[model samples]
Target: MPALITEAHDSTRLALSSHNPGAIEDFGLIGHKVAALADLAQNYTNSAIDSSELNRLITEHFPWWNDSTLRYFPWMRWPFKVMKDPSTYLKMLRHKVGIVIPAGDGNARETAHLITTLRNVHKCKLPIDIAYVGDGDMSPSIRAFLSRLGTNVNFIDLTQVFDNTLIQLKGYSSKPFAILASRYPRTILLDSDAVFFANPDDIFSMYQSLKETGLLFFHDRTVENGNTPVRQEWVGAQLKLAGRLPSAHLANNSLFFRHHIDEEADAALVAVDKSKPDTYMAMVFACWMNTKHVRETVTYQRLFGDKDTYWLAAELTGVPYAFEPWSSARLAQEPLIDKGFPLVAPVENNLARGPAAQVLEGASKPVSQASPTIAAEVLSDEKEAKSIKLLATDTSSSYDKNQTTSRVEAPHSTNELNFPRSSHNREFHDSPKPITPNRRCTTHMVHPHPDGSEPLWANGGLWLDKRDRGLGLANWTHWYVGSRNDEALKTFCETSLPTDSPNSKSWLTSEDGEQWHNEVMNTQPRWYSNDWGMDAEGCPQFEEWRWQSLNQGFRDRLERMIEEVRKVEAAWVLELG
Candidate 1:
């Protein structure tokens, strides 16, 4: 096995130096070089890969590729570099409101637009000390715009703190590093397109308890847009190794964090290096911070889209925050100035009881009635068969006597789920018993058993370990919980089977639910997984791929079913808070 890798402590170094051992310099020379190469790759990939240039280069001789491989380029030094000297940054009276605008011509139009709007139209009450992080001197227009704000706005040029290689990266790079390493104890990083609707000075005081360990980030309202495809597999593998949860939501526009004296700050920067398509930097940082225990608290609020940002941050950090009133939007996309801005204020912080609680917002949900106490069975009555079976287990003393087992009914919609009354009755059992071959059955007409047995189950259960064990149902406990879908497959597999267990059954069921047997299941080995393997703890290394794949299948059926059900039950929301 390869040596156990760990995060870096140096601010200048990459998160995982082992990936580019030759690039390791006196400080972070190698990491910087790799970042430069990544910048180069990003440019090439964006330009050539996205257009005719790729075909042109591929069909003809492209000297760029032949000139030097990415790994060995004579690295260029960053121009207008600003060293991270906390003393210089510390000179500020209070927090620094940092904004990064990446444009080709070094135009600060976005910066100018945001600040000018905040100063002129909104007339923000908060005394804004802006840290403009970008390249080149501000254009005359930007300078003139700042001059209007005068002493009210102390503009600091932080274009130097970021590496020169990152100038072309076209994403959030070194922003976290700049924020975390800044002289200010706290920082609120905003995108260039942000327009403040109100004074956000109180955000820092909202959750004083979490102000130390947890970084505050606004969750993007739309998480379904998906994440950048690059480094997803690699980051997923790292999170699994670290035993951290995949961020439920992606944070893009707004982030709040305090400078800390730990490896987590540096680690966030490294995560940037390790991953590509920097759109989801907040998520990547959340995962890294959670793994490193960098932040002890993670507080999310409905500051972004309805509750999108709040839930997404909650998903990644496993932390929770109450709904607040201070709401801002990217005017670039949402021209909602006519409708009045969303509100944001300090609300009570509520620790998520568990994963389910995080996702059960606004959507009225009853108690999860699914319990492990009543074992499930399959009974095929020639005339009638209620999806839940009553077959006897092998351990049962009397196989002839099929007990009338109490079973939970699948809700027509997620909101209608009737949970068990007892608090001790966990919504879904973390460790479910493995399904015996005889018990592994489905009811859906579309999904038949791989052995050609009758399909009896309907509630979208996960494939346990993907091992033969008759390819039996492993953990059906999570059929009701929406939050469990992504992590359920691996969690169930890790609990029910041995780490080294190889799938013995060639005839397995499909995750997509189109077919039950090997015809479909054999073809789809969890979505992105290339092979089946496990660590000592029984957790699959590439569980993200499988989880994503399996959940997508469930969502395909569940989402449509949900929409139809919601259309019918739309009036029921009047009862909710």
Candidate 2:
């Protein structure tokens, strides 16, 4: 049995009131000295402290740390406590890690797109070792693409580690599990649809914050205005019942972490159950981690998709995060060259080719592989010039022709044109363009869906048919009037369009109106493809100037269509009749 010893510290000496030979006899005055160490054995975590610091700090107190008996002692695990080779701790922290899940059929195409773009278009500068977790069958395209991308990618079949029980519980949805399984101490989990405008290395700047908190996430908004946060109490109740962390709304899918969620991981399956409504797997488990309180965390704003899941994660995590109103530009359609107007041509129609095809096709090849003749093909079309504006506009005003030309000059090469440099600067210029009458008439200028689908035109608004009827109206009103109000035309821009920002003016100028609709809207999902409630009669006629200026002629034609639709709806009866 060990004897109890009283420890006392003085200016030069440490004295024990009572003695315990086993605890202190080995080091004459080192009992207090050993206690001052950073406790790597019990509290091993990622940090700059290496074996040198460990040796320096320990040797100064107990110079016999390397003694065969002292070194092998279970209690004094030393530098190996944190890392087997403590010298490599800092180097491990710098190794880029990508925690990716290429699961589900929908993600197959997205997986190909991500790897292809990251390697070719975005040109990821970081040396990321992508650790993919999913069934091997789920990502054949991704695998093929990865082979072309060279040796930095890693593929892990879920069956290799997880037993049938965990795998059957829809484990593919558990982002935390996938993250924990990665070999890297620090990992970044990005969604498949995530498009990168810049190098992913920029994300490493948050490494300190990630290391400090052990976890970090981003905040995001919806594609249109349809997303509204669910009741906080409801989200809390679901999370608490399922054992998760309570969040404000949703946590962005783009997660960065220095640790993994291995403890009680099996219990986390309850969060991913398909039966539970609004129970997002990532949000549920992240919230659960918060309850454990072993890790520090922070969150910031970055744009993303899947609002319900992402928003719930943000709300439950309750980490300090930033929110940016406009952080990215989205994909849009290019008008058909022969038509001399902006139009979303059908994907199957050979004659309906647009510059967008060139952007995607050329994006897969390196800058040197592209032909100058192919680049000229993009610039030669008059409509391509307008499409380039959609890619780079800041505000609604007409884009500078010179600026648009410069941006589209080398369409075959991703490096030459930054693509989204915002051709229309957000500066509100003075223009006496008529508002309501012109806006109403130009409804014909609204481009048809790229795949020959008709838009959901109903009740004074264009609906994308996203089921949330208000979303269609809100989106159209925002584009037409430049305000977020559901009834923006009736409220914010009631009398006339405001010239300032939404807070001050609450309305959009003709230029401000054009930039978001033509450029930004194209980037969102389904807008350019869906056929929402179209008759066999086909889409509206094309007129470029009407869409460009919102002139009086376009408004007159659109008003007639609005009246025609109202008359048909009023005369028609329900299916019972």
Q: How many clashes does each candidate structure show, in the order listed? A: 32, 37
Cα displacement (angstroms), candidate 1, residue 102, comes to 7.3
Tell me the spans in candidate 1 whose CA falls farther than 4 Å from its real position.
1-109, 120-137, 159-171, 177-183, 207-212, 221-232, 240-577
What global local distance difference test value does model 1 have? 0.25
- Cα lDDT of model 2 by residue, 1-577, tens digit: 0111111122112222232333311222122222223223223233332234344443444332332322111122244566567546444443444445434444433344445545554456543333344544445554544444323666655434433242232323334434434444445555443433234544434234433333443221112321112222233344443234423212221111100000101111111111111122233233222221111121111112122333334333332322211111111111211111111111222112333323233212111222334433545544543333232212113222232112211122222111223333322111221222211111111211112122211111222221322111111211111111122223323334344442121122246444323332222111111232221111121111112222233233333332222221111110001
Reference-based lDDT, residue 576, model 2 = 6
Span of ten consecutive residues with least summed lDDT in model 2: 256-265
Please give the RMSD of candidate 1 to the true structure: 24.1
| Residue range 1-577, candidate 1, lDDT tens digits | 1111111112212433334433111112222222322233333321112323322332132121211212111111112332244334323422433232222223233344445444444444444444444434444444444444323655544444333342321233323333322333334455443333233445455444234323443212111112212223333333444345444322111111100000011111011111121112233232222221122221111111111222232333333332211111101000111111111111112111212122212232111121112211111122112111111112122111111122122223312222232224221111321211111111111111122122211211121222321222222212211212123233333444334421212211123111222111121111112211311122211111111112233323332222222211211111110
